[model samples]
Target: MTTPSTAGSLRSRAAESPVDCDVVVAGAGPAGLMLAGELRAGGASVIVLERLTEINPLLKAGTLNRPNIEAFYRRGLLPVLRQAQQETEWTVSYISSRRSDGTSTLPRFSGHFAAIMLSEELLDESDPDLAGLNPPDMVDLVHQKQVEAILADRAAGLGAEVRRGVEVTGFEQDAEGVTVTTGKGPIRCGWLVGCDGGRSTVRKLAGFDFPGTAPEITGYHGVADITGVQDLGVGWHATDTGVYLNDPPRGRITTVAFDGAPAGHDTPATAEDLQAAIRHVTGADATVTGITSLTRFTDNTRQATTYRQGRVLLAGDAAHVHPPFGGQGLNLSVGDAMNLGWKLAATVRGTAPDGLLDTYTAERHPLGAWVLNWTRAQIAVMRPEPHARALREVVADLARTVDGATYFAKKISGISQRYDLSGDNPLVGASAPDYELADGSRLADHMHDGRALLLDPTGARHDLVAPYRDRMRTITTAPLTDDAPAAMFIRPDGYVAWAGEPGRDSLDEALRTWLGAPVAYPSQTPDVVAAQR
Candidate 1:
């Protein structure tokens, strides 16, 4: 908990510290801040409580997937994610594969969906550090602090109160609302959102159970602004010793294997140890300018069985913790907020029932599990044993030759992973591409505001959406004219809410699931008006 006046914002002093809001977000990290943004976008009254004196300088989650980018665009978040960049250059560092025998260098791939989706070209590993992602949104070069501050500003702009240095000590909640006890003291609110970190005080006070296995093996990772050391590709550089680098061309970020590190302890990781490991992996002593940030974490893959308990609920790390192998923590946190904020806002705004909040945990908990399972498999394949290497080789060869790199690529990039329930089509619950509309327009252009968008066929009835204009944005079907194109059925989070041919029945069904009811587009042509009548 920090004092209000000094948490790097004099702007707070100009305005009164809010005692309460509809939603109170603890922890000013990306997760907390992004949740705040989503709540604000949905017109929810929000208050963000951060104990930090300032924002974090480290760039934590290094990448965001295509699905995430699409989500951002649909939700009107790409502007914030990209800021000023026109295009972003994603880095494709080194890759490694190990089985029972020995470790060998595997081919590198870009986290940028364009390279993976359009070209299959692996860029230099250091691309994202200097440039941004494709379209400059998902893979922008904003530090954790910068992104946090950006969201904080957005929250404030959207009428949400953001209080820094106000440490949230605890909370008391009932059927109605919540009263939060902060370092700044007690404040009352209609709802409290615990966006606090893995060791959340809010979760503890609420007695929310974080049910999952804590990894016996831990991993240590550090980021240093170093000079020298070229591309290692993007993947693990496994020794019988155990190491996996989020490797970049300029300076790869390497981590000790889960088995390599001591169990249960998150401490004892230092610059000296990281540099030594770097030396071993690169086979050279590179220039170590300084450590931007360092963290030693036990891989704990856990999620609260329920995200909400009464008026108080949890989001981000407060609700779940898993290995960072997928770079999903930040995205997952945003997803949590994206899932919950709108639903919570609708409830608060008197449009939806409180029961909708339960779906937040339902949708996201399993997504985290998939990431957990995949990372575990990746860790197993990287194990430094002859037996493990042999087992991995047989599968890896089969996957590549048979299943192909595209499948492997999708898995690693999170493109292949779909949700538990995708409405009717498999593509519905999956990520939507930055596709072209039927009219040769970009899907993003139609998502001017944060609303569910339906990509209707050129002649399909747009009148169906016109009725729910406030809740839905409708676009005409168009073929891909350029590299970037419009897509069909965009959830607020930018996932393909629905796919295939868009019709009256299909569009209405999608609206019901995503927006809670039937929606109508604003543009009502004379023909559409006649048809409705």
Candidate 2:
């Protein structure tokens, strides 16, 4: 609802009013913390309010997909992420369980869809989706708790104030700013972002429209001390009743039953409940001796009609919710944060182009919708009925092939996601490939500062971009590949905004489109020499 007039008025009012921070973020989950760091990197002050006093230790995503990994890598978080991965007992045990020769009894996993496993070995190397991925593109097995910890530390290190045990109860937004009501007190900010989970209070108080389908399946995921189920081998198993996954090293198990959604979504499922669900799915007399932690989930697909309304915005699960079939939730949420953080920061700093903030929804809503349908399709493939079994067989066969596995891998890992940006270059809207520059540093190496970059191999386009040097960085680096563009503009979030071949390159429109009109120098000539000064 932030029309041009309202937006202009809001900016005017925001400047007149004093605020606690540039942005106030609800929820300290991975999405919120990631966004806090991103905002700080863009030189925006941030305050993160969390309802929980301590980090939730419940088992969640055990892997970071390609896009998720890349997001951290661009922020220079990969090393600490790897260190945290090594510290996790589950990761250590899982790694040690494999054969000392670095092989496992199970096949090498690329990813899965509806519990249908895909082997990394069967992936098509020639697949465009797999091309140009640097070493960091490989999926990393890091616990969600570790991810939260890493991001929380990073955000705090970057000067974002993260207040725990503070919950956002209500909020009011206007042209000027937002007043957020919380348990501790009230806070005023230029912008408000709800990285809160699916049931977001900010979205509700702000009256954002969220519409989507209902849940038909109840899923249980947890870690427990289980016994009397040695026959229930590790990995996904599809039985007549439902599907169950047993991973002994991780002491984690998941059961998907089409027995309607759980009545209580917030309460943790009991050990007996998990035992019963496991028995129902696996047809084994599994006994849950004790539960370390447990949670209930469902395939309830929902999405906010729009991610923004005036100064209040939504991201992560606040914007969309779907089944966790492919472990896509964490990746999807992080992607939302990565997309919104820089744009919101730019708006706070008064450097964003007109409609640039709105593009957050325009670019990410389709991906949210795509993920909703993606999880729904998995539900269809996972139905316990006979017809679904037939479909599963066909899907399983397809998944075992190189092309099919690669296709699913591309989607599940989120490498195929591209913003519908306008440009003739094929790579324009996609995540920029980690191109090796002439100096040997990868493209990701220069993105730690979270500024837009113009990679000019010819070094001839500096004059065109010098005026916007504060908002964008110009790098004189040649690509190692012949097919690479003559010059490329990469957004802060690592997406290719524009690219052109030799002699065909033009950056004026792209720069203006993304970075807003250049800061007017004292000189206005096309060849303003002071631009470099």
Candidate 3:
């Protein structure tokens, strides 16, 4: 938690605000709402502009990966997420499949690359590549709408104003701030963030360069009343025509055809259109009698050249977009919000280190490119041609092996994602372990307030971090095991800034690099002061 003096200083800075808000978010999707809540929590004022009055009830992304689940847990919202899962029965089997003892009640399927499912039984958990990775309990199925609702409520509760039926038609940024032109009126903010979806007006208005590969497949995701398709079994079917996945119990069917991009994305999909896609992809005599919800997408991959242009920034799909494969879109968006929220807020409060905001692009852009290539690799393997099909067969054979399964699980489960922080300690750029403290509480229990943390498990590093009390919290815990770091400096977004390794950068160097220079606390003596220097 931030100290009172620091909180007071931030509040005074907000009270002296010239703009209507510190940040203006251009979308109310999961990414936008999550950013709003994070900004408010970090002491930045925010206003979220959403074009729609109600949440979109589409079955877009239906799963939360490890990082996203850990995000919710750190915010103390896991109970709410669990409640949402229970209420909606959306992938409730995933929740029930795992017992309290952490063993699966059913066959564990981590995820898939392309259409090849990765069975956990074939994975070697003891592999060094799997160290400090996500446990099965951290992954679950949660609806995107539920996540939006949850983040919206949280943002509102934290004093963020959300305006519906508002569209951002234009935006202009000068030396100081951005003036957003909207349907309601012009909103002035110190910073502008585009969290809108793929066709982002903010991106266009702000003049950010977006470039990537063209689409080779048109995908359709929908749920509808069906008939004449009794043999359309569940799971992925990589037929000669294309790939199709069916979930009969949920009345959901997804089909991807190796066609060019849709004629026009503006046109809504119809039942006949879905029926045609089903027939084309699966060669099944399937008929769509009536549609419940339907949407069309293409494997059009693109990413922004940079995340920030002066006072304007982009996140989520606005920053990067690709085919919605492996349920990575939501996770990627949420991660952007998490990584940028604290840094933007610190900058707004006039406490950010030099070039801290620039790191957002430096770190996230490569990961976005990786996800694009990941989806592209899947598309190449599932291309509906003989060569691609034969290659997919060979890939499938590899996926059935223990080592191959682990590799796929690492990428698909979001465990292999790490920022390059240039440190010898392997944990430096990885997510901090949820270590249990001496008081019997997990490390996440102390992070709900969105402040950095210094975990001194051996109780020997307190003197080194005493001056940065206003910027972070320090907890002394029981001694960590030999494999874990003796002490770790964790950032607000749960990444390890530095671990106390002999050959790595010192703790003071990391603290200043990430959180700016330390303050002079009265408890600090000349010896401690010299140590920090």
| Candidate 2, backbone clash total | 0
- Residue 112 of model 1: what lDDT? 22
Candidate 3, backbone clash total = 0
Model 3 sits at a Cα RMSD from the real structure of 4.5
User: Residue 265 error for model 1, in Å?
Assistant: 4.5
Rank by TM-score, descending?
Answer: 2, 3, 1
Please give the distance, in angstroms, between residue 260's alpha carbon in candidate 1 and its true position after superposition: 7.2
Tell me the tens digit of each residue's lDDT in model 1 across 1-533.
Answer: 11112322322431344435777888777777777777777777777888877786554666666555555666556666665222222322211132233222553343321011211332232432212223423333334455566667766677777787899887777545678998777887778888889988889889998887756555556767665565444555555555556545434476555454354364556676666666665555656678766777656667787888877888888988877765667767777776777777666655453245667778877776776676666556656678867876665554444234445545555555566655656566765555544544565666545666665546465556665556566655554544322236676666677666545676667666656643333555412211110
- C-alpha displacement of 512 in model 2, angstroms? 0.3
The digit string of per-residue lDDT tens for model 3 on 1-533 reads 12323545545654565589889999999899999988998899999998999899877888898889888888878878878877775466656776786557877887888988889899897987665555324436778989999999989999999999999999887755778999888998889999998999999988899999988888899989988778877888888788888888788899999888888778888888899999988888888888888989999899999999888999999999999888889999999999999999988876777788899999998988999999999999998888888999999999999889988888887877789996678888988887655555777877887888877655565566777776687776653355667778899999998986532338778988888867777676312111110
lDDT scores of the candidates, listed in order = 0.61, 0.84, 0.83
Residue 281, model 1, lDDT: 54
lDDT of 3 at 355: 80
User: Which runs of model 1 end up more than 4 angstroms from their true locations?
Assistant: 1-19, 77-108, 111-146, 225-235, 244-249, 257-269, 275-290, 395-402, 420-427, 432-435, 438-440, 456-467, 476-490, 496-533
Model 1 reaches what TM-score against the true structure? 0.74
